[model samples]
Target chain A: MTAVASGGRVGDGSVAMLRQMIRIRRFEERCVELYSRGDIRGFLHLAIGEEACAVGVTEALDTDDAVVATYREHGHALARGLSMGAVMAELEGKVEGCSRGRGGSMHLFDAPTRFYGGNAIVAGGLPLAVGLALADRMNGRERVTACFFGDGAVAEGEFHECLNLASLWHLPVLFCCENNLYAMGTALRLTESETDLSLKAASYRIPSWEVDGMDVRAVREAAARAVEAIRSGGGPHFLEMRTYRFRAHSMYDPDRYRQKDEIESWKQHDPIPTLSEALLAEGVLTAADLVSMEEAVDAEVDDAVSFAESGTIEPVEDLERFVTTPAPADADGGRRS
Target chain B: MTTVTFRDALREALREALRSDDRVFLMGEDVGRYGGCYAVSLGLLEEFGPERIRDTPLSESAFVGAGIGAALGGMRPIVEIMTVNFSLLALDQIVNNAASLLYMSGGQFNVPLVIRMTTGAGRQLGAQHSHSLEGWYAHIPGLRILTPATHADARGMLRPALADPDPVLIFEHGSLYNVRGELDDHAGPVDLDHAAVRRPGRDVTLIAYGGTLRVALEAADRLSGAGVEAEVVDLRTLRPLDTATLLDSVARTHRAVVVDEGWRSGSISAEISARITEEAFYDLDAPVGRVCSAEVPMPYARHLEEAALPRAEDVIAAVGRLGGCGGSDG
Candidate 1:
């Protein structure tokens, strides 16, 4: 008999996974609120509908594994165990922020988790991930680098170049493509002449799998397989997790680009409620238990907000503190020895 | 002790790095079976195998970004850009990502990656292939720029660069590849933070690097014959520049002349000259002068290319204008 019957593995991990996904959902809702209030500057690209893909894939990774992400990464950073307070503070550009006010909303970074970056450039993180995997191979490390990009990145030249190098050298990398069916205003079909993204990957002989990102269990299963292959020295594996974002590409997007009915349609298959209902059907949780979980996550998010708000602004004199290390001389020359 | 060409010295550096540390590896276009664009990586694949000696597709951004990633992932990657001219393709990675990662991550990551590329004008490769952008890279922080002028530096700098905690760009003058020099099996460690005096004299200081170093030395010899003693300083490290050596030489000679192969406007020469004026303005008796290439695309014609670049004649004239006394050796 399966432990949870939610088509997932047994025991405490099941609960922990639920909590992780809840953390992302609740965290993003708070980010949206904060952005509207003018607390978090710059554009916010919340991964509301896509939380499962970020949490599930990152959960399968070891702390040593490097993570390279794109603009829409509040979920990934939270899933990687970056403090929710620091993430919020970074979004608020406070002194307690992970990047210390250097990289705002779109660029969340944590060193201890080995989170390499929150690079906003499209398809820019691909090569960095490939290189990181190459480093692991050369150093004889069994670690895998988890690179997360969107369907939009598959069209970039770095995508092709990275795939060729990763497969050619058999470097350990997990190529996680979150295909949400849209690249900013343009749909995937509009941007790519060839709509089969995995075909782009297969051209380099990389084995790939597709999963329903709206289903947590499905994402977990697909991610587990890809992660297992990479950790077990199976070379690089690709996954095209079909996902959708509940929000605009960014805060500035009028979203006249996408239809509201399509947005409402994705909400019907939303990962959070969809998974919760699945858990309820399996008798893993009740309406009351789910309500309690939601309350707990909401409280945690509130505490993070208060912490971020109470945090002080980094002194203007100390603004360029970590800009270089031993940190002397920043690009703007704010760093003083 | 064995005598090797400048390119062989570079290959030797790669071989030594690969054998000594598992973290070190080579990646670039045609670096594997082709044995490097300039044959500097010749005979490496046979020894280290294809795993260590990798060949990349013609994607500078992806491969260069991957090199930065590999460094963050804990490998000491040496990414060759085929030529510095082609480095523009991956300029985003070098300037934006690699140069900013350590500080941007709040000191969480240090790239420790070495990017090697052929630079300077020599071969009549025309407008695109004959430009030097080392000065552009040197302008950034979180990066150390090394211009390997001598065969020794070409062989020696890679070890220290691989050992440094930050990313380093090793600019090997394309023309210096064939220049041969004898070296002992064990070469001593050279500091990457200071400039070194290549030829000592008294009346004036001749400062240059990369392919221009030879021209500076030749100009010094010409000055000596013309009764003007010139001190030649080779700036091996461009960023966190060797201002100490440059200033001390100027203090002794009371005159300075910089020879740079980059364009005249907003070039490495401009930065060096500005720094000298800022730090050693009182020590100089006369205004510091510079001989830089014409501010235009490098023409492919042999005579035209020579006229467009810094030469001994140009440097000799610049030094003479800087008020170098006849053979006044200090």
Candidate 2:
């Protein structure tokens, strides 16, 4: 409900936005540390710098709308209101985590939050979102399926096919492209000669938009309008959230793709602090309040680490479970998102 | 109660599934006004309408991917490929997306989709159109492969598959679509995990599926003439292979012969033979053998086509090789 061009305002909503963003920032920063300490295994893809896109887009949706995120989806999961304890416990591979620790960080899932998955395959969630939208349409529901994929996913044939079908059928699908400059190591420019992703969707006759992903408010506003369109049977819409990932694509990258100065240049427009500064200038909350809020988030993340530490490991016997739904269809371990 | 060909059984299954569930729909090339390429979906478009009986573009990957999406979205989608050869174009969606979604998502998503494709050669359709890739799909986890050899299975497997929470591939032999038989009862809900004994015997176990089942049964009759009572086992499902039935019969018979239309080298028959050896080698008096199609692209000539597909003669010869286990007694 608050209107700020990118991170230029400190309205009543600023503190909430800052808190969510900081919570994700602290959670993933600790994740990177824990991953190094061997507390986590497998590929840990942290959404360190792209917190604005998750928080902003999620802020625009309701509780019932569906969300399908990518591997680098910790921020999205956190912003969607999946308990920090559950997300942290998932990363810790505990049975009590969102997907019962079956989904590692790259595969976080919480069905209750309507976050469909933390799909590891690039562009895999697009078709799934289209399917969810199809279900919604058939059920005569007004829910929109916001599918989050990286700019790299645009190159995948699934993306093209899904967008075409969604547009042709007038399905309520919001194709959210998180253009974080690079696709793992291959930069966006390398994949498409025309690096503008929204244009690609437009090429498919789908409605498209571009937003400053560095600014949470801009992302939120753009997402709100697009989602509103989709919810009202406006068919499908595409948004290119031009953001950046400060960390390596995953834990494996050596930061060989972009220069530090470029990172520093983008860091100037970091949504968390920039919005806090504007909020301070607007007299909504003082610098003390921002610090205290961040401190609270830090403490909350610390509690998350404690919860993850105390979380119980799934028994080895259940390892063969969930691969198939087994004899009973409903008996499949239903997600607790 | 109804005498139906394999094609009508499939059509009946489609009609029943589409009528029974609001979420179940049929989609593929020529599945609409044309009454389907093989007529397995005949009268379905007229009954279910164009929306539910979707006609897709020539793009196999796109439509198949869309079907997977629809399945994930909570719809029971039965996508037909017209023939097994065309499925290669949609392999990315089937093998990659539909098959891997469950495991990759850490069991968060289950793709409840059914893909039906006409398979095998004998109609002089040539090398490009004739293939039996059930073995390749069997190699992939997360998918259930069903090769129905009877009217009951063709009618029965669809309901359970529509209810199952994962992808299931049904490979129907194009050559057997016209094979009709007297039906006593409709199979209500069949298990996708085991095999069925179509014609029981005692001497040698004749194991086969899809296009090869008829040959196995014919061979069993031929063996009966020679006093060799060959038991026939139809492997309705291939993935969680009903090795239990295949080996159990082999253990009793003291010999086994697998008949598969797929090529022998690394075929499903090869795998079944290795499994029989591993599980029931001690129970056998002779080594297990296979009556698989000759390793070729299935030549276009009618005689060549006949040579490429495993036949009753091949099964009889394989059964003849089990001389130690009563074949010599005959």
Candidate 3:
């Protein structure tokens, strides 16, 4: 239940982390091109700059632990080990997608990985996370439900209600607040009177922490600590990851609200190069290693693109499928004998 | 067979579900210690314990969404909202999450949750506490809407609703809680996919469900005395409507009249009337008639509130307008 200590020396773990972040970044960059070329459409929200928060928090979770993420969840899905091809196929709205193409970029779902959804509504997933944890607790399972949302969710009433319920019922839930400065076009200061998200969480009597979201190591440490506390029956824990988005809120967003300098400043601390260069400086990762990693990521993205391109569109006739599970023939008007 | 109130029958159903399945639990505002706002869960807390019979805070969205999550997490949660009007606060959760999850997730996740709420305008609870919005909920695709119009349905609907592998919403008419009827001791889960013929007649079919079933039956009684035989059809399940039974009854009777507690425009009665016209248009002896609640928020005064709601007089008047009966509104 203790937090993992970081020795500040680059190792295989750091290399893997860097590769993961690179995979997310490169995959989304390819999506942007596909989206412009009309291969993929709909509201695509990229987590280009906030990759560290997704990678670190997901790294600390066990496979059995559930994850409820937001619309900006490409990084979260990739980090949670969903196959890149499935996510890509989903973005392309193909039958082979994670949600069978029913959910696009904002609604990715993979049950085997325990990823609840790519919920589009802000703060919508908090209550679900609380309930998932409640089910686990009631069943005597020590599993944690990690919920990821933006700072915008902090203003919603469900956020407060869920926090209070999770703490009051002693449910094991890890609340990850990815504060990427702005909720779409509106800045946090304009929307939230109290900008300290962790402080707001603490008001509900849950343990809270604020971490450097740009640093993968910091996010990992804080997440591990929080998950440990939750698994050890410390109730719910909140982490306010102070991060920024390097891209517009969505593909449709003009992003005219924020200054160009702000976006550039956040890009300077992009989690991919930050960790890679740290490893390079520490002599643990060579220039050759960096090139190979980039090549591997490129190949993976290319393969995913090909898979999505070849993915089939679902037939229009089956549109009504899954609206409700099919009932047994005899079960319709028959009594329970 | 034993005589029991609708409230007792519902409680027995809840008890049976909890006793049979470990995954079954009841949760909502004042569902535990407060014993439910209408006293339907009066003695449930001591019998089932606090964990299963949970009393949530006044957070409709949170608890309802939590119920959806719990259902996804492999538990059968029966969520109770005190009234229909209050459910608006959780509309996003119900529409966006609960109803859409199974389809949106490509059938990967199905919410097997049951949400129970008091609906219908009666008892002069005023506008906020009264409103028959089950029709609005029935408009949703992924949900199975059930209205327990009879004691057997009140006792029998929960088991099947829970057994369903999708979300189900049960609208319990507040006025029927104290209504007494004979329930078979062996009463068990009934089918949730059909309408029941409460009374058989040949002249016309009087369609109703939940609270309005009583109104329809009362109108039928008056019609019988006037020598105008009126059949009473209780639509148990509003969604996935028993179109077969509806058209069959209309086919035989050659006339139909829908009585709905919900307002006329875009109401379930409108949907039923349209379906009748669409499929059984040739079988009609006359244009289908409808008696619905007046288009106004319920008033506090007993007389105004009663006047705003559909009564036996409304149904009789509707039948008279259809030229199916010579009986005038009393």
Candidate 4:
């Protein structure tokens, strides 16, 4: 793990991180193609330039650690080990999807991976994360609940309430604010009176810091430290990841909010190529290795698309199935229906 | 049977829930040190300690959403909102998260949370505190809405509500806390999915719940005095409404009058009236009548507040308008 933090080994771990980022980048790129083809519908929020934060922060979490993410969470879900097939199937509205097709792009959920949701509401997941951490603390479990929300969520009242409650109770929560500059076309500067997002968490007495979100290593180091501190009973910690979104807020967004030149400027710091170049400079991965990784991701993305294309739509007879549990109390370990 | 006030029965239910399950915990404002706003959780804090009987800050959205999260995390949480008015602050959590999670997540998550709030107007607490918003909550599909109008139900409903895997909202009428009655000694977890025929008759049906159940009962007595045999139906559950029992009563009575503390426009009472006309239109001898709160903010003046809320006399008057007072079918 220190290799990940101290840049000691640009070995399998480093290559794996870059590979994960590339996988997400390629998967969402395919999603864009699919969206244009009418194979995927609903609001699709791509994590194009923001892959580093998802990869680095999620890698710091333990297997049992819980994650609650925002709508722009295809990268987070992928980095957390949710199957590409399931995510794609969910995007395709197939029953084989992660949430059984109930939640499409904005609500991807994986119970086995401990991914709570892809919450579309700006700050809705914050309180849920606080409660999850409260559960861990009360149950004598040393697990961190990492909550990922955008800068837009900072303006929501739940953000203030959740931060205060988490700090007040000494709950183990990693408050990761993905400061992607704009919140659904509303720039952070225009909406917030004081734009220093870390101060919001500081107001609740929680220790906070900032990380260059475009740099995977910075995000990993900060998240690792925060997760370690929380697991050691240090209560909640906050990290404001300074990042940017190269894509529109959603598929329907024309992205007229920013200049095209600004996107190209941010593209110079793209996490995928930047990390790839770092790995190449360290002699951890050859140019051939990078080509092979991209090709592998391409094959994987194709398989996922095929899986999604062939996936079945949940029958209308089961329309009301998951709304309430269908299992009888006697059939399923006293689980109420 | 043990005689107790509505407050004591609720306290006993909380005590039982805590004693029975290790995973069960209660959290809200003033629930611990302040012994709850209306004394429903008076001594439970000392009994269960601060861990189980959590006294939260006035952060309703966080606490309530935490309740949903805790339920998702495999803990049973009973979140107390001081009253229905304050619950508006946490409405997003309730409506968006608690109510929608299970359905939206394709059934991977079900919020096994119970939110209890005092509702309805009678104490003249003014426009802010006095309003029946339970009808608003009942409109959501995933939530189970309960309104216990009896001491037995007050003592028993919490258990089954806790046993439920979905989010259940229990609206405790603020005005009924001091109302005393005998809770059956054998009372246990009661069904949270049905209505009860409190007083059975054949001339007309008076449907009411929560704070207005007593009003409907009194109106039935008044109708009996005037030679009209009126049946009284106590709708214990507002959502997944017990349409069967209501239709049965309506079928027998042939006339219906709905009494509600919420405003008449788009209220749960309006839903019931429409349902009766839709499901049992042929059985009705006249148009369904309603005695609902006036569509005005509840005022602080006692007279104005009383006028704004539904009263037994109002129920009688509404029934009288249905031509049921003379013991002869119209």
Report per-prediction Cα RMSD to one decimal.
Answer: 3.3, 3.4, 3.1, 2.4
Better of 1 and 3 by DockQ: 3
Instruction: Tell me each candidate's TM-score.
Output: 0.92, 0.93, 0.97, 0.97
Q: In model 4, what is the error at residue B115, expressed in angstroms?
A: 0.2
Decide which is better by DockQ, 1 or 4: 4
Distance (Å) between predicted and true CA of A298, model 1?
Answer: 1.6
Ten-residue region with minimum lDDT total, candidate 4 chain A: A328-337
Best by DockQ: 4
lDDT of 1 by residue, B1-330 (tens): 889888988888888899999878898999989988999998999999887888888989988998898888778889999898899999888877888876676666778899999998989999888898888887887788999888778878999999877788999889989998887788645678778899999988899999999999998888888788889999998887878889999999888888988887888889888988999999887888999889889999999998999989988877766653665432
Give model 3's DockQ, 2 decimals.
Answer: 0.60
What C-alpha lDDT, on a 0 to 100 scale, does residue A154 get in candidate 1? 86
- What are the per-residue Cα lDDT tens digits for candidate 1 across A1-337? 1445354433425555677789998888877777788887787887888988988888788888888898898888988999999988888888788877678877778888878778878888888888888877777788888899999998887788889888987889899999999988899988889999888888898888788888777777788788888888888999989999988888888889788899999899988777777667777777887788888888889989998999988767665555455533343442421
What is candidate 4's lDDT per residue for B1-100, written digit by digit as tens? 8779999999999999999998999999999999999999999988899999999988999999999889989899999999999999999999989988
Query: Candidate 2, residues A229-279: lDDT per residue as tens digits?
Result: 888778999999998887788787788878889989988888888777867
Give the poorly placed runs of model 3, Cα more than 4 Å off: A1-12, A328-337, B324-330
Q: How well is each residue in A180-234 modelled by candidate 4, as lDDT tens digits?
A: 9998898889999999999878989999999999999889989999999999989
**Model 3: per-residue lDDT, tens digit, A1-337?**
1222245323436667788999999999999999999998899999988999999999899999999999999999999999999999999999999999999999999999999989999999998998899899999999999999999998899999899988889899999999998988999999998988889999999999899999998899899999999999899999999999888999999989999988888888888888878777777778988898899999999999999999999988668778887556732221211
Q: lDDT of each structure?
A: 0.84, 0.83, 0.91, 0.91
In model 2, which regions exceed 4 Å deviation? A1-12, A328-337, B59-62, B100-108, B185-193, B327-330
**Ranking of candidates on lDDT, top first:** 3, 4, 1, 2
DockQ of each: 0.53, 0.45, 0.60, 0.64
The CAPRI classification for model 4 reads as: medium
Clashing pairs in 3: none
Q: How high is each candidate's interface RMSD, in Å?
A: 2.2, 4.8, 3.7, 2.0
Tell the DockQ for candidate 1. 0.53
Instruction: Indicate whether candidate 1 or candidate 2 has the larger DockQ.
Output: 1
